[model samples]
Target: MTTDTDTALEVTPDAAAAEFDRQVRTLLALGYPALSGRSPEQFAALVAPLRAEAVARAGSAAYPAGPAGPETAPAVTGRVPFVLVVGRALAPVERTMPLTTLHGGRLPGFVDRSFEPGSLERFLATEEARPPGRDGVHLLCEVERGEEFCGVVPGDAMATVAERGRTPLTLEEGIALLTLFPEILVKNKCFSLGGSRCGDRRVPALWISKRAPKLGWCWEGNPHTWLGMASAGARHA
Candidate 1:
């Protein structure tokens, strides 16, 4: 879903770096400190590892598929469900999904594109009804590769390459790093909707996060791509 427009900023960095090196260097440049309100040195130290991790993973992880599709799990009833929408047909793939986030925002990498328009309205309406803090949000997700990313900035252990004099990364340090880079995520996977669309059609997973969606930021399907969604997940009433 889109960030609350008022919440959306003109200067907010790209959700993820499109061109990693240029983005990193621009943020690290001396004049760039104002972007994060941090000194250049401080900003550079925080984001370098994150850029490396994302780049490395994007380059290295391309394994052959073992299973033809995601396991056929069942829908969970009673507990809040994360509806895994894949095709134009709105159906549940799995339920009782467990997802976490750092900001009020959904962990990005769900998919780069936005969700359907009504998502935020539903989220706000649900939040207005809630006591406060817990999100019973509906999301129209255009999911991404789940095995690749996480919502939280990864721990210091992820800092593989380091400056000679600086201490290596740590958990506490990683958490603190968010003040500078809210987008950095721990290397982990979330539920993925990738390969759900086998044919040229594009479908979305309207998962209920904290609870799921029909976010307005959904990706428009390409006419050239055929849609093929797997029939996975259990159906419950």
Candidate 2:
């Protein structure tokens, strides 16, 4: 039988770096939310640090530092596979465009529900399915595309609910959280679960936002964003 090792081949550092840059550019062309507001130079700068960190973690053989300098390197650790969860908010009409444009004229009906107590478990049972990845640092992304700005929590991170007061999450906080953990954040507005499946697992769940768009946000034509959740078994591969 063909194993992962049989298919696995070595990649040079330069080739890997070039491929990474290419992927980033491709994502930008696809209207990634993180790269939307920033200029090309600014976007490059933002991703530079991340690229350095990834290289350092992967080691010199897989991703050498090159002429960039040692400061760019991130601490080395074990590697794993990961999936990014992209979410976005859309109006009844706005949502139709992506559905028609991206999914061949059919509308996808993803339900909206709060992440209350037992919500994760229920979602896992009903909505989520296993995703493809390595054994360590597995990632599962759940996006909430909606009209309003809601909050998101990392799958690995925990949240607490208060009885007398409101939840401990805000829209900005949620986006920031995803930004901080870009490995699991797809940073896109449109996604199709049925078509975008990894391995045998469909996905954990997607949280479609129901809030209104925030003012001063750069992306046009769409007023929503996505938040993805991931597991420890998932990582960026």
Candidate 3:
């Protein structure tokens, strides 16, 4: 007596793996869409006609940044585990490796549907509020081969985002938002969250991006951040 609903909900290892891969690709694509996260075939699809053009440019690359400033200390590049609460969904973006995400769509080969409009700005605003004190965010980055290290997020790095036109989130506005009540920003994700038992704690695994490469936020490298998000719901005032 097999029902269609049971067949649809059956836990298939392959399907779960695919879901995880999608999320990982989304994270990496959002973080460093310029490079990384692709197979040779996928890369070919993205560049096909322009592949050689890009290679010609890469081979002629120069040490343009010259030298690092006190600002760019800790040198390597990295990004924090981000949580983007969009409309009725949560888009988690991270600067890390994409596990099993396979090809197609712009550069870095992410599932394009993963992103939502204007979410990047909101994410940037959050990061600017409590930046990684000179030491850098919790990201374990590997920018220079054999010279891997955690990268610094300059106090004014948010300004760089604006200069590059990555996001419209102005550094000025981010600083201002920090002092206000957290509820104003709106955590619809949490409000919409439901939970299940994973032992003692009720894990809000659903909070992870729909594109995530794994089942839970603990896989995000910053599980503790969820605590802050949860507690913020009830203001001490």
Candidate of highest lDDT:
2
Model 1, position 152: C-alpha lDDT score: 19
Error of 3 at 100 (Å): 8.9
Task: Sort by TM-score, best first.
Answer: 2, 1, 3
On the 0 to 100 scale, the lDDT of residue 15 in model 3 is 31
Q: For every model shown, what is its TM-score relative to the native structure?
A: 0.21, 0.31, 0.19
In candidate 3, the residue pairs with backbone N, CA or C atoms under 3 Å apart (3 or more residues apart, or in different chains) clash, namely: 20-213, 23-211, 23-212
Model 1 C-alpha lDDT per residue in residues 1-237, reported as the tens digit of each score:
121221211211221233334444533542334434457676555445444333333322111212211111111111111121111111111111112233345542121135343332222111111211222111111111222212312221112111212121111111112212222222221121221222222323222233122111223232111211111111111
RMSD of 3: 20.8
Comparing 1 with 2 on lDDT, the higher-scoring candidate is 2
Best by TM-score: 2
Report the lDDT of model 1 for residue 139: 14
Per-residue lDDT of model 2, residues 67-185, tens digit only: 32323221111112111222222112123112211112123322333323333222211112232333211123212222112233321121211221212222222232222222222
- For 38-148, candidate 3 gives per-residue lDDT tens digits of 453453243233222222222221111213311111111111111111111121232221222211111221223333454333433232222222311111111111001
* lDDT of candidate 2 at residue 10, scale 0 to 100: 30
Write down the worst ten-residue block by lDDT for model 3. Answer: 141-150
